[model samples]
Target: MAPKQDKKVEEEEDAIYEVEEIVDHRRSKTKHNMVEYLIKWKDYAPEFNTWEKEHNVYSKGLINIYWAKQPYTLTQFKKKTHEGESSIPKKRPASSQATKIDRKQLAQEIKSSQISTSPPTGLVWTDIDAIVNVFHSEPNTYFAEVKWPGGKRNTYIPTRIIKKYNPLKLIYYYESQLEFYLPP
Candidate 1:
């Protein structure tokens, strides 16, 4: 009887809990730039859900899934934190910051924009003024928001395509966002 009691205690000490789901995620309050996730245990009730830091959670898939559902991208979130600005700016930035391109020309081009019927020759790298934003749209697929020469509004172009034409722009954009993309 003593041996059986000791065995049970050992089993209890080594037990591992399965994760039911990742409920949510948030930046850690006590740690700088730390991410935490709300976890639901496989066999536990709602009240038993707990918050775990990014490193404590073993499954990277859960973190990716949680982020996929969010409207904005991780790079956008990081930009907001570092710049102390909203993810989407409400007003146009100061002329010193945004006046490199001609706004009136960009507005006219956008208003008169038409889809070409000719066979696609692919993107002309020179026409792209800047790579401004990035996001994950589908499994293994990523997109970059590009600022056209006239610069009234940005458009989405697949990052893979940009890599073929001008990889430097993508590299620079990623550096500015302070994000590193690694597959799990």
Candidate 2:
């Protein structure tokens, strides 16, 4: 029984946890030490402790990370964080900064904004802007955004409408759209 206890202790020793880290290359300059590093964050990575065991290179010096998520050059892994969710997540303001916001109202706003239309009676609008994706250049795959009466939106709309409407004409519209939005 004593021997079994000793073996159990040895097995527990093998289960040691090592924290993983990321050294961001974009924010890093070659140096002996003290590179730009990222602490393991929530929902952005596999369990850092487990990853450390699998990779065998658990040190911050070996791994690279970014303040913002991006494609990893070494492992070709995509590191993604949920900081910028489609709908803003409910965050409790620090108790130190004591202030009250109607949480139910905030949630209601989020629920409406995230959805295309409301549940009771929703007016379905085709994702017109999304369909007209404007790319860098005209290649095999092209893109553009078809402007509706409203602001910059990401929805698909039929191209024929662009030809008929004066404001909706797809001439050098990409260049001019900024004129309306930005000062010369």
Candidate 3:
């Protein structure tokens, strides 16, 4: 009679462990430099989601399935805190020395390329004008130096949006976003 009761309790514990679905997942690093998945489980409240070690979750096929369902190829994974702020560290302004060097290098590269110095016009400006700089400010993140329809050059536009415009066939079949050229 005691053995039968213990078996029923074990069955109940097994039911609790079953995962119905995976809501979301983010990769995080532990103090020991080990990678883990911060998994948000379906049917469970957000507070109950757990960060399971990568090795443990990978063997169970949970992480792979989650990645397949929602593919995000970006390098960084942003996690939010309880206060609604992002956990990712803010990007520091590029140092003046580094900025100067980058500017010189970019100038030389652009000069050699066939890309026009004038702002793009009409349909091109609306569809494919490239993002020239990105700022840390809220509400507006990208600054595009566009050519107005009338051939006006260096007209800076503050936009909160930008998207990938070109892909390169270099070493890794790499994809590049619209060029971001910081003004001197």
The 10-residue segment of model 3 with minimum total lDDT is 166-175
TM-scores of the candidates are 0.39, 0.20, 0.26
lDDT of 1 by residue, 87-108 (tens): 5645344354353333334333
Model 2: ten consecutive residues of lowest lDDT: 115-124
Write candidate 3's Cα lDDT for 82-149 as tens digits.
Answer: 22434553533446775555445544443444234333454443443333332222233433333334
Candidate ordering by lDDT (highest first): 1, 3, 2
Ranking by TM-score: 1, 3, 2
- State which candidate, 1 or 2, has the greater TM-score: 1
- Badly placed stretches (over 4 Å) of model 3 are 1-5, 13-31, 59-184
Kindly report which residue stretches of model 2 are placed more than 4 angstroms away from their true locations once superposed: 1-143, 149-152, 174-184
lDDT of each: 0.64, 0.35, 0.42
Error of 3 at 34 (Å): 1.1
Q: After the best TM-score superposition of candidate 2, give how far the Cα of residue 14 lies from its true spot, in angstroms.
A: 67
| RMSD of every prediction | 14.8, 21.4, 19.1
The clash tally of candidate 2 reads 15
